[model samples]
Target: MTMVENVRNGLLIGAGPRGEEGREPWFLDPREILRTVRLRWITVLLPVLLLLGLAAAWTHLNPPQYAASTQILIDPRGLQVVKDGLTPPDQASDASLLLVDSQLRVLTSDDVLGRVVDRFDLAQDPEFQGRETLLGALKGLVARLTGRTEPPADPRLAALRILRDRTGARRLERSFVLELGVTSEDRDKAARLARGVAETYLARDAATRSDTTRRAGEAIEGRLAELRDALRKAEDKAQGFRARHNLVGTRAQLVSEQQLTQLSDQLGAARAKALEAGARLRQIEGVLAGGPSDSVNEIVQNPTITALRGQLAGVERLRADAEETLGRRHPSYQAALVQEKAVRGTIQAEIRRIAAASRNDYQAALASARTLADTLERRKADALKVGDDFVQLRELERQVEASRAVYEAFLVRARELQEQQRLDTSASRIISPASPPEKRLGPPTPVVFAAALVAGLGLGLVGSLGLELLAGRVRSRRRLEGHLGRSGLDALPRAPRGVAGAGAFRASFGTARGDGSYEVALARLRHRLAAAAPGQRPLVVLVTAADDRTGKSVLARALALSAASDRERVILVDTDPKGLVTRDLGAAAPRDLPATLRERGTLGEALITLASGLQVLPRPSDLPRDLAGRLADALLRSDADLVVVDLGLVGGNVVTERLIADERIPVLLLAVSARRGRLAAVDRALKAIGAGRRPRIVVTDVGARD
Candidate 1:
């Protein structure tokens, strides 16, 4: 078999399945960023060195600042002299934090710092009399321009401002310890200022406490006087009310109530006496009528009544004896009878007297009871009349008691405040006094330089990344392939300077050997093509670029020569209306391609053959209206094993668009690796060709690989 037939059978293969486009797994690729930094190391390093130098100079030229710090414990509840104070002490954690924060503010307040300034006599010192700042100078300049005069600054105020600017106060985290720090150029001044601030803060706090106590004591004293007057008035009113109502008695009861109670008792006693006397009188009367007088307890107990009864009994016995012994009228019996009769008469008279006495007693008792009842009734009326007055008097007395209570409370508070005014105490005390620092503030020189170096390197790295993004060039093969979503793409090195335009094309696949980079790249491309689509006869390859002057025509001619050198039937067609490839290959024809097509000429009549046995079909100067149709017809009529068409500057014409749209025809997109926007241009070309089409990319003018 011939070499052409061998190549056709061995090299031509059907296209394999394409890989699926993958999403970037990571948001940012550190390796790619590092590669970009490495590529532009000079851009990154310049800023780093510059910053390092600047830091070194700054550390050397600037004077060191000395700082001194004093620590004070803020305890609002400490050294309390009284139970109730002007400011209540807070014990909650959040409240304590807020209290400490407030103390920190107080430590830096003008009240404390102003005293500090006076104690140190900083108003006259040059250190405290600082120079005008830039902003102040600008203000002064503006005032002068506007013909306005500013008042002279007070030296004390200026010193206070300077002290406030140079000093700082902060509370330790999660604690009540406040640290007051002062910075100055002079070490001794720094220490003095720190100590002065602490001392002044303590003095101010003590003075505030003492003043608060004094003011509170004064206020309590005034309130106590008012309360005393009110108490006096309340007592006077209560006494006057008591006098008017006659509601007088012991502490417990009023006189009207006591009198009414005594009257009621007497009335009961009188009524009982009257009932007893009436019972005795009735008993005596019964004895006089018919019943036994002995049954009357009063009469029975009377000595005279008892003796009479005995005499009458003796006489009656004598009379009975006389009546029985003397039948007729005898002198002795008559005398006994007369005696008995006299005794009986005496007993009766005694009984009658007793009964009269009982009746008198009954009448006296009844009268007494009636008088007592009348007196009690009058007492009750007086008591009822006094009830309303008593209630009013009690209300007045309650007011007096309330006033007295208030007066007493104020008196106690006043006494406590009076005692507190004598005591000198503060809420915070200095735990650590300020001392002159051994070293300066801020970091050491070596540390500063190291930090500067790191900062400059970071800045430079950011700058380099920015420049890389702005340039937008393809630097890595993996990145190019990843961006295009295909593999097996080729990158060709820049041609040798010794070889010109046509010579560079000829050297790509001709027998004349030159640089190995371009030739080796071409060979790799051919192998990739053979692997890309195997068992495919008469393969159509379209060579194009995003923009003009990207060596697409040269690449197309090289591809054709490569296949022709392999003894394969190859044809190179120029579809560019400019006929750039035709002029470059020096292919001249007797007739233009469109005119020949219009006349129905044979493909050979318009074709130009090179010494390498590669046929060329050049484009006309003016493109035909149906360029895509004509190109399709020409491609159909061709009998070559491999047809290479140079569709110059993709998306420039409808013919190129139609050719790219055809899936059967594979596209070879030429890209300049060094050109900005090259990737974006290639992406635009791919999108125009449509998403289903996967074009083989060739990155040209690449530098030497590592």
Candidate 2:
């Protein structure tokens, strides 16, 4: 499709229903378009704002000056001539448009503006034409600073050019319409410039008409002289022919006399011969046919005799056939011979009849000769009577030729005059005239406004979408779960309550109802623990976290419920000094490591039973070089099939490190969202925990979706 066709098709289709199966109504669905626009709003608006700001600044800071125009309308035929009409001469539409554009160039030319500058003495101005006064010098200094007062063109031409550049003068497409526009801060100046163009057009029109008419007259005069000379030559040839041919009438009369004499004699002789032959032929034919024939030609001319001869021939053939059937000496043979003889005699008689008929034809020729003699005498008399009248046609032909010459000259002159009149109009027609444009032609305001609005919207969308694309924050649930390397058993939203509700995990983990948040998390963890190492003795599950406040105590409680809820006794340990996990889960504050070691009991006695089947033990407040001191009292979950111990944050710095390290307890790694749950962080924590033996990695605070 052509560009125009595509544009037209788009317009037509845009106006029609544009929809697809299972989609929103085309025009009404702004979501996709709006989304794209929002994404680019900032990109589009920034440039628009710049343009608007520049426009505003220009309007405020720049002093507006008026632009004027002076137009000279030329016929482009190079006629330099004028014709009828007060308006500019009418021209072909295309030619007229060309003239307008050419005029535009001429108006902007430096030569023209130079004249205006010199005439106006513009160099003496305060800014331009003024003399070098203090104000002029100050303005010059300012111009130097701003680089404003620079011109490569003549001032007058520059002025005109400024006007022309701001103005529009063009013929309407394919029509006899021309408009001129001049824009200026001074409306009167614009009007004056436009009016001046019309004035200039009028002057041009007059000069062109005068030149056209004058040249036409001269051309016609020159052609007419050539025609006159040609006419003279034709006439001279006719005159010379007449002088040379003095025999013209004589030759015509002689030829006519000769033809007349010959025709008269031949007519007389033909009549005499026809009569003599008729009498002689009658006598001969009468004797032969046994009757006095009116004319033998009449008898001989009849076709019946020839037909009878043919019949006789057929009868002879039949007789011959009879002879062939019989013998030569028989009666049948003799009879056939007799019949053949009779038919031959009849043929001889017909020949005699023809000979008798022609003898009269000779007599008739003699009679016709006598008759021709009389006719010839009469024609001779007629020819003698009409003397020299045959010569008149020759003189008449000369007169006709002379008249044709005169007519040809007159026709030539008339055609020349006709052609001159036609050239008179065609040679100097003005293609277009000057008039103010009703609507100014320039950068369209509505388009500019629409563009700016779209640009602004686009810029805003761009800023928003760009930030989204460049961001390295939380993305989707899949990536979050991938970091954990396990199922996201449960999750929490960003709640203001923090970790206080962790006691529910403890309660859910076979703990008392008063210990709320920790019970819930523990129950989930306990379920995992029971499934992971089912029906195993000394099923110790060591818990550790990446950082503080990651619900380690709660996990231990939930794990304990999974173990002892089925009548299995379970022990819990908090190796974190801060007791953050214990406090959030409503457990008693943890004691110092040294205090536990100082007790009479071993590590098993350090555990405090919070409910029927669950017990809590936390990290110590003092230092213990070795947790092996408490290992002697290490509490075994005799009443439970599983046990969960909170090893707290991983590292040698933590007090629980050696308990797992030296004792070789099975450790479970726990990570939380607050400590940056990314694959990199997970890998780092994995590496740290892997320093001793591999630990089971678990995650906390992963989200769930509908």
Candidate 3:
């Protein structure tokens, strides 16, 4: 592919999926972003409310804050003098930060606090010495009961820390505009204080610079005077030598000749250096490209040797300069021998290169120079032979003379410059003078109030919603029915005032005839049961539950009434101790359901005839422990076309397994909550009832919105 196509394809691959399906992008769902915003809205609201509430309470309980502000211009560049005419960029920043940070420390010191207390004359606030009247005692008691600790921050520290905290010094991007802001309760004081700081800092800057320049001038002056005396003596000596020897030249001409001779000597040395550099460069290039492999330990890497050679050349240049200026006897002149000896050690590994090409170059250069020097000596017979001792003395005398001349000049100039520096303060002058600001730089009042108000509104909504969430209760029929694992009869409408709450026969078949209600639902439940067992007259419909109040009583009545409407002999029975099948008809909590096993006994006679072609035997009051065996016998009886029993509370009033001793009877259980109410407890009870008691759990109530 062409470059553009290749680049496009690569980007497409990166952006698109590696496999057939791509992962979702960062922000595909706006709803998730909305959710995040909502959460953050609460977080932001919390802090705003806390700060404003405390501030408001503080104002109401105590006195109003007398606000003051000061305005000052900060040098955005944070420039400070390190030395006159030598203020480095890095040094100025370091100095400015050090000064500002130090000043901030000073503002927080005990000194400032002592000043503020003395100025304000505030030694008699009531809190300072507690006075307890009856009301005050009561209020203090209430405050203690509620665990409220509301003491104000120290006013002096409060003032300083407010500036220290809110004070912003920010430099505008790519420009020299700095923002120096401070907020205080006292507007006039804040303004004056800021201006005072600005003025004091400027004065300090000027004074410090002036003193530094004066000190530097004095130090240089002393050295300059000594150098002046030495220069005079050097001049006298030079003149004496010239007069004694009858040397013919102006003083200026003699100096120029000396400089020319020095350059001429260096020129030859520089050429020798060039030759050395070239050889080293060639050796390095050869190694850098490729060198023959070596097995011997003595063999050196040529690149390493070449680097050492460059350093040796640098030493040679210094040696040449020392020899030319010093006569051969100076310490530097003597040290040249020692340095050359070290270079020779470093060069030992490069014996091959020196043997090949550079040995001849060095010999030719050195021999040519010595021969020229000998010729110069013959030309001037009185000229000294240059040795280390002679070189030392000559160079020392020359340096002292040169330094004397330069130092005298520097002394005169520095004195003049120091005076000029003291006066040249306008360059660093305050560009914008500090003045009392017309308005304080705290956040705009309306903006702050609006932010705080919005925050409160948001927080209030969250608190309301959170409370609603925590108070979970059942509200819908579907959730309850789902928990029961059966379609519950929403057959009966809510009872009208003064009407029969039982809805009598009307609540059966999942329908209320007079109520004009969920009889429609009862009709559906009837259809489902009949369809399941078509043409089966002896169909067994067992109704039971794991726990109480799971709509088991309501379900039994509704089913029986539905089947009875279809001309089936429906006998509504209350097998639970918590309720009587007829208890609303017979009207009492059942004490037992299991002990009534006989066809003709007290349990059997408990049957009450109802108006709607149904015989209802209400449960007698008996504890569950007295009825388990009888219940097994009673359940096995085959008399009624449909027998519906009101079950007891699951895991509450009765353990179900003991009651359901007859396993042949298939069980249907009721549950009050499908998803939310404790399911594990219901499940464990069902499991205890054994596999034969196949209790189907139906939910009764669970809903998010109640």
Candidate 4:
């Protein structure tokens, strides 16, 4: 069977009587909610109209604010014209973000804002002076009512506060561009202020850069003077050290060292000359001491000696001739011998003279060499004595050179800084200047109205739900289902008043003249019962209520009539001890079901057939103890295609409970009026029936009773 059928037949109450496991709760019905909203539409419209009127008045009383913005590009590369040991601009993501943030702070800083304020004389502007606007007036009134006083503020401070509030700066996403904006009541003023802020910031930045360069140059120049003094002092100390030590020197050599070198050269030449003279003296002495004069090259090569040797040979020849001619002393032979002797004597004198001269020359050379050696030794000692002073002089000269080098470096830097001061410019520049805006700041009037409408509708829906909750009535099928914890079958209209006995049933369920809504409700209930069974066996529909006045008997008869009109065999059983079905259907002298069962042993004998072909089984005034058994037997014996039992005021009798407990039977809970206590009783009845039997709730007398 389908879930709906199972629920109707009380086969799956664990899933909730209304099959609410996967279904929306009955109270959430959109149509019902809309109906509630329609009933209290004024609640929604009031808020909408009120908000719209307030928006209109606000717009009329207050002047529109206009916003103007200027764009600045923060390019670090712009300051690359001169490098003066300043930090280079970074373009990496992290560095760029930091630089942009720092620049943004500077752009909105008091210094930049102060310049703008001074340029525009904003301290005198009425807006900046805190003139009483609508909001300001409201604040003042509230302050007065609260008995609070505010201290007077300085004009400059007030102008600064207002300027800061109206001006803002933000960097464009992932870029070096910044957008500075200003808002004011006057469009021209807004544009001018925006431009003023941008210009002021740029000018301040440039001035800061130039001033920084100038200060750097001044510092370098000051340091340069110190270095210059240090260099001069170093040079003077070197010169004084040299003078104090008597350490005189050319750039490449000392004076004592030069004298020592000259003496060393003179000593070497004198020693060489002495050795030559001694060698010549030895040769002459050897020749004089009986060595062969002719063997000596010096004596052999002498011109006087050579001539004397020739004369000696001639004199020997003459003497030999004289000895032979004249016997002992011939005068001519004697003359020849004398002449040879004289020539020999002359040769001997010349040799002795040359040897003497050689000795004298050697003696003079030895004396000169000895004197020069003595002078050279003294000069070397003097040079060694001044070695420490020369070292100190070199250190002083090195210090002077170092000082000069440092001075030159600083001097170069100072010049560069001076040039930088001349060319200094800001890293940021205006990329797009501010212009007067055509439209005001905030949303247009129509958009505000639409927003108010939506807000009003939402509040209206909330109000409707609250009102419905407050009423706490089951006025519709959905409300009935929600109240009873079961699916609603149908909502039957109340019968017209003044119709008594069977006339009420005729007016509600008459085939030709019945109320359309009541008849249609009955037909719908009949169809639901047929659908719930869907079997060849007779469909048993039990109609019960929490209490009387629920019109359960009337609904049971109407259901039977609606089925009979469809050409189906329908039996209307009134199981109430009050005989409500018999009285309402106008069935005269209805045989008691139990008595008929005891006498005839068949429910067919007790059934009263109506003119509409609907059979009725009316209950006695007092129910018998075995009434449940007799009713079951009577139902089995009958051949009706549909059976609708009227069990009035359920939970009041044991027989009704026993009949409702049957799982095969579909029960309809009639709810004519919903009260908190009555709903509680219905809930208790459902729980007592157990999850194995779920009943369908039928709301009757809907509009008229609720």
Candidate 5:
């Protein structure tokens, strides 16, 4: 009682008036994600365990499977007894991959699998038969609901399907080997099936080659018979033509060609002789016509003609002399004329005889030439007949040669086909034979369990993240800051152990707890406030929430207690009409706040100090319209260094509007365990209030979703 009275008497002492300060927009911190998972570990781990359990149950109910494997060599080049140039060579290229793939297809073809099924009699086996299963039961239930009945799977089809499902083929990397595996409930059956598929493939391949060879041989034989007949006919026709034309020489020439050559030479000689004769005849004709002549006679040699001309000239000279010396009728002139005429007549007679002999020679030469030409013409006619005979002969010989060549080629092909058929082998061969397996072929129990565990963990993490996304709640300080568009001033833990109660500020600050976590957080809040409004003493921080139940009143009290503990005077004002703060502080409600404000009543009378030395102002029933200015003045003049105004929840109400209207007054927005809907309400309120900037937000009770 004495200590309580002493405390009551002590007036509020202001150590130093503290002010608040400044601030990006929000950013994500990965540590917050880890914190979220750590806090909600139960929510994340439950699904994981359930998934793992289901996986284990499923594996246990299914029968263990055994696999048997056999290896086959896929040689790109097939084994052939004869290598012909007609067949393209197998080269190492990307095309080899196509060959390997084709082999794989053949391995799984219906022919191979059908043979295996028939050999094993798998259709009668219970394993391949349709039976009740979890999936089958579900399908049946669905079918019944849909009013449809499904027929049973065919035995042969089911067997084929099972074989295909259980078998697998994979090519060995960088090699020509292929691995074929078959899985079955019975180990021996798996081995037998694998071996059977390989044997059937080889048999089918060999049979295909043999059948192809046989067909080719039959075709070759038929073509060879036709070619032989054609060759015989061509040879017979050629022989007949040769017999008729007598073109017996193997060389492409005829005997008539030689005769033509001899006749042609004879005709050339005759023609030359005739040309010489005609020239002589033309000289004779020219002399007879008295034009000019150049001919020689046997009687008048070249020297004789020259002598005669000399004599005639001498006589003419004498006549001219006599004519000059004597009169017109002189005897010497008359004798000269007679002598010249006689000389001229003698020369003419000789020339005329030569002309007659030339004519006889030309006629004889012409007759001989005509006879030679007629003989040549008769020989040409015979040669033309021979050439006509060779035409059919040459065509028949060409046909015979072509037919023989074709017959030879076919004969060679037919022999090669026979050789190929005799030595045919499959492109692939079994290299490793399958044997019954001793252990199960599927993944080991431990490995399967580990895989299931990993998958479960992944699914659980995805599910937890999905739920968080769906709820769209701010469960961490980082998220809160992001939603508010600015970093938060402080964060409070939800129900930390050793904290006395939800709103027990005194219990939170007790020394017995060795500086409570909540108390430390409050100290940080005070530090933030001082930094936000630096150099300004007696800062008024309006504390409000987006909605009721955000624990704003408790936060306000905590802040006040923290400020006072720092040796600074702090005032807590409750302006909520709900009376949350008033009931919590155990204070009497103030009456007629509007009248008190109009008259400028004493603020000291309205103040009540708590047990923790935290001063509180009860909310008034009636507040004046100039509440922000009045409150600001009161807080500024008061002995308190900091004023924490608790306006329960910010709304469009006139009271909240008045408090947030003042720009000088720093607002502290208390966000507690807020969902997307609550933040949406806060955003609306802020917009309606027309506040250009966001207030300093403080998140409390993190991870407590509402």
Candidate 6:
């Protein structure tokens, strides 16, 4: 029989039902997924082993490559022109990173790569030039036959590409050092290429620096010429202004000091001479007046005046003698008197001459003093004019000095640039040269194998999971509810070991009332059923399963037993033709369900009340096809506060379908653990029945009953 037909037969005869069975709980059940994977062990293991083998083969075929590395110092400290305080720490660090990155780009640029290629003559190398090997030739032939375009054949480009791939440059973290590495099949070749690339880069960097410095020097020279011309013009303007103002001295003075000093001395001498001359003139006048003539030093010092005085004294003596010798009018007395008068007249003439000479001397001295005073006043006026000129002169001097200073500064900068152009080089340098590598860079044998194993296992796991999901299994209670558009009532555990029939499980269901996992699950199922049924008046619940081997019969029994234990009268009608429930309850089959449908028997005549106040109507009938309305009518009239019906194997069974089609009855769908394709089929079937009520779902175990 087909699987569905067999399941239908099993449900009727108390045989273990079969088909798609068992759904896991809503959350991911890792244990179940793992169990599924284990079930397809070969499918998982074969691919894994194959992948590992391929990895191993690849590792063996490929030759190992050696890497050679050189260390370069990226000294951008020279590029930091700003003072430390001027730049923030974060900004400085960012700039340094940018500078280092720029240098790294240059190191790997086409120019540097081309130079390395040329210097090493990499065009002749087979690896770089992509020379045709036997395998490559075959592949090319195949491509041509297949009308495929061949790859480019430029040897220089090919060499460049190869060189780029083999070379790498990276900056060491938080440091000014860079590392350059080259990989090659030949250890010595790798070292040689690495060293060659580094040297070529250094040379290029130096040449670039020299070219930059040379251009800077030329620019500085141009600026220097402009500054020099400006300085010259400033100096010339200052000089011309100085000449115009006659401000010729290095410093301005208040007066012509030397001339002023000489004139002052001359003026003092002239005043002294004038005072002496005036004193002499006064003395002469005093002597002529006959007042203290002895005090007249000038008259006493004059030889002519002294002689005249002596003669006058002698004449006076002779006159006195004559007067004594001869009485009145004697000739000797007359002659002495006349001589004394002449001497007096001569002394008067001499005194008058002296007075005239003194007046002439005083006039000459006054004239000299006046001339010295006038010259000194003229010198002071000229000195004041010179002092006024000094202000503009000093400003012009300052301009000239400033321009000169600027011009000289540019001249010094230009000279420095010239020196730099001669000796300019890059700030970076290769601190350590590459050497031949002692060890190959490829993974070791053991490590490769281990990694291959891990990778293979991962691929296998992924492939197995993919297959399991693709099997279209319902997989979880959440998915089942999603397909059915309703929530599940419960998720019950699998029956424990040695628990055989639904009858054995139900008989002992309430014995372990103390929160055993299975007992708790059944109690929850009972509670949800009560809640799902419409308000209180003898709620009739129809419990059916999508597929078989799920404990639909046992679930109904547990629900009725729970209601009975709660002091409510409950009845379980096993509508399945198999009489599985009747055997479990140890109750004889009541009357055939068709007899009751024909009104020969009542539902109460078929009811058997247990010690727990729960009643069972086992194996109601081998349902008659045309008695659908009669069976539903008899089922509804049972004598109980609650009615639980176990309709096993729902789809393709007309009797079960007829019972589920009752509008007043609520349907509870029981899902087996493996609900691969059956849950969807059951959903479609129920929809076709169109009872206008969504069935509540309950996930159940397949292999074991609960």
**Which lDDT values do the candidates have, in the order given?**
0.74, 0.50, 0.50, 0.73, 0.70, 0.70
Q: Which 10-residue window in model 4 sums to the lowest lDDT? A: 7-16
User: How many clashes does each candidate structure show, in the order listed?
Assistant: 8, 98, 54, 1, 7, 10
User: TM-score, each model?
Assistant: 0.56, 0.40, 0.47, 0.56, 0.54, 0.42
Candidate 1 per-residue C-alpha lDDT over 541-620 given as tens digits, one digit per residue, 9 for 90 to 100: 88887763436766777677667766678888888756677676664675777777776666677787766677888776
- Tens digits of per-residue lDDT, candidate 6, 627-703, equal 77776666666556788887767664777777777786764555445433355556664666566756665665522
The alpha-carbon deviation from the true structure for residue 487 of candidate 4, after best TM-score superposition, in angstroms, is 5.6
Model 1 lDDT, full chain set? 0.74
What lDDT does candidate 5 reach at residue 553? 64
Cα RMSD for candidate 3? 29.3
lDDT of 5 by residue, 98-119 (tens): 8888889899888899888888
Question: Which model scores highest in lDDT?
Answer: 1
- TM-score: model 6 vs. ground truth: 0.42
lDDT of 3 by residue, 1-706 (tens): 1222223322221122123111232123343234334534665467568857855654445432333333233332434332335333344655666544554444334454344334443233332233346687788788889998568556555544443453444444433334344344455555554444445445655566577667777777767767778777776776665565454444434433454466558557756765775565455445434554242222354576667777878888888999999968899978986887788676664655444454455566666666666655554443342233333444545765686669767876676656645553423334454454566444555565676677776665555345423433222333233333434222222323322235454335223233122333344444445555565444445566554353566666766775666556777766665664454664542323333443324544455555567767666555455465565445446466666666666544453445554554544544443223444455565676666555544333322111
Q: List the candidate numbers ranked by lDDT, top first.
A: 1, 4, 5, 6, 2, 3
Clash tally for model 1: 8
Better of 5 and 6 by TM-score: 5
Q: Where does candidate 6 clash, by residue pair?
A: 12-578, 21-674, 22-672, 22-673, 22-674, 23-672, 23-673, 473-676, 503-584, 593-620
Assess the local accuracy of residue 393 in candidate 1 as a C-alpha lDDT between 0 and 100.
Answer: 79
Candidate number that wins on lDDT, 1 or 2: 1
lDDT of 4 by residue, 144-252 (tens): 8998969768898889999999899898987889999999999999999999999888888888888988998898898988899999999899889888888877745
